[model samples]
Target: MALRLEIFDLQLFIHIVEVSSLTQGASRSAISPAAASTRIKNMESTVGARLLNRTPQGVTLTSAGRSLLSHARQVIQQMDHLAFDMCDFRGGLRGQVKVLAHTTSLTEFLPQALSGFLAAHQDVEIELQEALSDDVIRAVSSNEVDIGVVSTPVTTGALWARPFGRNRLVVVLPSQSEFVQLPSITFADTLTAPYVGLSAESALNRFMARVATQLGGEYRPRVQVSTFEAMCRMVEANVGIGIAPISSVERYVKSMNIRYIGLADSWAIREHILVTQHLEALPVLVRNLAQHLADYAQTHLPGPVELSYGNP
Candidate 1:
């Protein structure tokens, strides 16, 4: 009879080899050191060979163990893939899709998109994470997430980016603020207002700086905030005027007493993109989701918005 192998046992063995200490491996596997030792012994008994060499410093894999380690890892990975594939087959559109997006997309775009998607296909479960635009691209490139929605340009050579929509950089002010009545204002006028800027590290911040310079205004902001939502809140509280993507403003519009005005400058357009790594064989659900997003983009973002790739 073939020996019954446990997935946990295989995971424990791999962890032991990687960590080079039974204590460390046990800690990682959430198993007691004694239990870990017994499991290794059982594995050796079944295989009929010693798998590790113990020294004062640490444990090293034996020749036999070294030979088996690679195969063991491959087997574990294949098993994981098999489980996902089985779930996909059984659930059909109900299978989970992991997605990563920036805060703006998460707050503004995904809520509507996911609602429509779920309404159409009740079986699909989406696992969405909000991250920075750069982090979103990295997640998609590594296949950690099935899709990434970001404001920044795509950088991964192995991934494909499709233009999803354009977001306008609108100047947000308190409802009672004097700037609310401005027909159209230049970037200089915006900079002159008490500005609550997004983080200096953000792509929006860089774009704002470039536009400010073009309009011959110094890009010195009075308050620096970490998130677009926070910036809008600050603006609503009369802390200072803020410039952010219109989508972000739309997200907090109901709760905040702020008015968003479009900048007259042409440089205020920010394009949003959807990115995915090239799949050898695309999954049916993923293909359907991609098509749905493409159709939505075409329908909503009717006019051309300026697009920049891999820019600060």
Candidate 2:
């Protein structure tokens, strides 16, 4: 009789090979190192071959281990596909979509788009998190997240993508401030008047700092907050001015006692995109949601939004 390998055993082997650490691989699956070693030994004995060579540096995959690695990946992929198909058959539309998006997209356009999608597909659940443009690309490429909404002109690296929306940067100033009357403001001029900024870690804030550096100045914001709403509120209190997305602060201008002015700089305008591993390979529910977002953005997002596909 042929030796039968359990799914867990195969998974353990794959993890060990990928991490190059037996202890780490075991820990990942919540198995003891001793038990994992025993299982690997049994598997080797059953196969009548050495799968890995132990050394001081760590284990190296033998020829047999390399062969099994490819097979393991394919089998896992197929199993995932099977699971997705099974869930679809059991229900018309129900699955979880993990999504990562940049700060601007999260604060601005994605809420409405996702809300519409949720309304249409009541059974599906969305797990959304904020990430920078680069991290978003990396997450989607590694299959760590189901979908990603990222800033445009970024390299997506073999992932299928389409234009999701556009974001325009605006200066948020107190209603009674002198800058409120300016038609458009430049970065240098805005900084001179004192600024209330987002957290230092935010991509937009980093870009703003870079702009200041180019102008031979430093960004020393009077205050820095985590969210756009918070920044707007601070500006309204006359704490200082702020740079925020128009979509984020559009509804808050009158209520929050803040006025927004468009930035004259080119970086003020940004294009965001929807990215996935492959459109055709996506589960039905996930695909539908992605399509819905794309459609919503097409009709709702304002001008100068580039809704095109590009290679990473």
Identify the candidate with maximal lDDT: 2
Q: Write the per-residue lDDT of candidate 1 for residues 144-232, one digit (tens) a residue.
A: 56788887444656676677776767778888887677755667666667889877766556656765777677786788898888998
lDDT score for residue 64 of model 2: 91
Q: List candidate 2 stretches off by more than 4 Å.
A: 1-28, 33-78, 176-178, 200-203, 206-220, 305-312
Residue 118 lDDT, candidate 2, scale 0-100:
84
Worst 10 residues of 2 by lDDT: 303-312
TM-scores vs. true structure, each candidate: 0.59, 0.73
In candidate 2, the residue pairs with backbone N, CA or C atoms under 3 Å apart (3 or more residues apart, or in different chains) clash, namely 156-312, 157-312
Score residue 107 of candidate 1 by CA lDDT. Answer: 58
Pairs of residues clashing in candidate 1: 94-123, 94-124
Give the C-alpha lDDT of model 1: 0.73
Q: Per-residue lDDT for 126 in model 2?
A: 84
